[model samples]
Target: MPIPGNLLTTAMAVMPHTDPERAIQTALSLDIPFWPQLPKFDYTEDMYVQASEHFPGIVLDMTAKTLRFSMDKFLAEFEETMAHFDDPAYFDISPAYSAVYHRFLAMDHSKRKAIRGQLEGPVSFGFNIQDQDGRPILFDDTVRPFMFEFMAKRVNVQLERLKALNPNAFMFIDEPGLQFLFSAMSGYSDRAAKDDVGAFLDRIERPRGIHLCGNPDWDFLLQLDMDILSLDVYTNGEVFGSYSGSIRKFLDRGGVLVWGIVPTNMEPFSKESMDTLEARLIAIWDMLAKKGIDREWLLSRSLLSPATCCLVNPDGERTVEEAFAMIRTLSARLREHYALDGD
Candidate 1:
């Protein structure tokens, strides 16, 4: 919760790929902190979820296989709850959630301060769990409320797990599926996206953030009590061009804007360079300044990434190499240009 005293233009990287020791070193060298992501290591992984994927749990009463949670046998426990939903204390994400928390604690020393953890947002996750007819669970009113409550609980659980390691750390609500949730899904009633569901989320532990790789309903998303607004730096700038006024209000209020400048794909990743990156960043800062938003004020809340996800382009060699290199150079530039370390 160190309100980023200065501008923090840094990289958000995939932990498995980044050498643990090197990542810490790179972070300090880059003059920014690291956001560790472990998606590949676990798919139905507690933190991340493919919200649109029709997970089997919604149908057939939460079968054991459907839960498929084994990190700490969460699936087995989930099966017990499903078999006995009437039990007074049938909670979801139970012991596996507990085990994941302890596991993360052991990782504290490896990855330092402000360690980040993520979870799928309610609208997206709720809809992902499906009914037997292959319809979204969100379509079922009886199930929808439960889904939201669970999503909120799950997010809080994930935050607690991580915060038990460092209370001030951040917890990102990985709501990539929100684009569709608010745009096309049935779950999106006027109140579903904000008021009703947000009522539960308002109590979540740690600072909450949402990442949108595609365009989002900004007017609605800006409603959440979120601390950071992460956008696909490459595409969002073009996608949300007209919302400059609202964005300015958000920025002015000390809310961090994660400008995902790095291309999540190849050509753009390869196409960008230090001078190009700096120009783009300064240009962006200048753009907001035009709206009467102070450059330095905006600077304090800006977070950077090479791409939303690790430069995932089939042109892997060129794209990944350039993307990683850009991280180092970008970090150095932001540090030196701003004197982040203090001479």
Candidate 2:
């Protein structure tokens, strides 16, 4: 499936509020509703927290929302866990998972193209999670491969649940931490990175997308066998533009470009109206179109989203709501101009 005309702000400001009702409320309000990831709604729903389900010998500090592992014990149990990776006990679909998903199950689907679900990408998961020695698992020879395998299988679990609702279930493997891939670790080669990421991408039978907010290896990501390459175009649009050849090939091969054009920061959010943001996106698109890319092809293969998740102020739920409104407004403006599908 191509990326939908529906807004990809599906994972927007779901933190800082613990009420399941708020997640449902937010999803209900979207032009193209999506399941929410409300870690604040349930600490257990935090990206790493939820990933802890398959890792044995990992200590969960609910108070701090961190996972600690005894390296020896984790490896000792590795074989046993691998044998039962498909067990229902390995994936915890609870609290916010049910809250957001149940609402999606009940949604009026006649007009919907697909459902969007999110998971922590293997790179980001290993980067964020630590061992008892406070070491990031990404750099660990013993644990990193295991983490990658664990996350790869975790996707299978998520897909099974999502496919039950919508066959065209789209999973956006959020990998914001990939920007640190080179700087934060040594001995991690592009080939190694490809293998690590490919482990998951190769297994996704349904359409899959990758979302990265920071400047990453565009050349590497665009060539992946994935459906969508979502980026923070509002901030890094020029960076991506520098790789015209690769971008052209990606589009030529039927990959979708999810233009993350809406600003997630407050300063830009305050200054830009829907018209201005739409213009920004058009300018970028026009540049690409001029480079021998077809305008209609680009429009048909693109999606609009905020550059990043909206940052929520401690007392500013309304501000978050406004951010979502801005995304929908921009999406509406794009649809008006492109005649994109939205019902």
The digit string of per-residue lDDT tens for model 2 on 217-271 reads: 8887888888877788888987788788889899888887877776656677778
Compare the candidates by lDDT and give the number of the best one: 2
Error of 1 at 109 (Å): 4.5
lDDT of candidate 1 over 1-343, digit per residue (tens): 4435344445554433323344344443443344343433443332434321222243221233242211133333445545654432232344332333334445543334355656667666655554545666566665566556656665665565556666556766766667775555554476655665567567576477777677768877776677887777566674454567777777766687777776646556557667887777677666767767777766666766665665245553345445656766675678678766422
Global lDDT of model 2: 0.70
Q: Estimate each model's TM-score.
A: 0.74, 0.89
Give the least accurate 10-residue stretch of model 2, judged by summed lDDT: 5-14
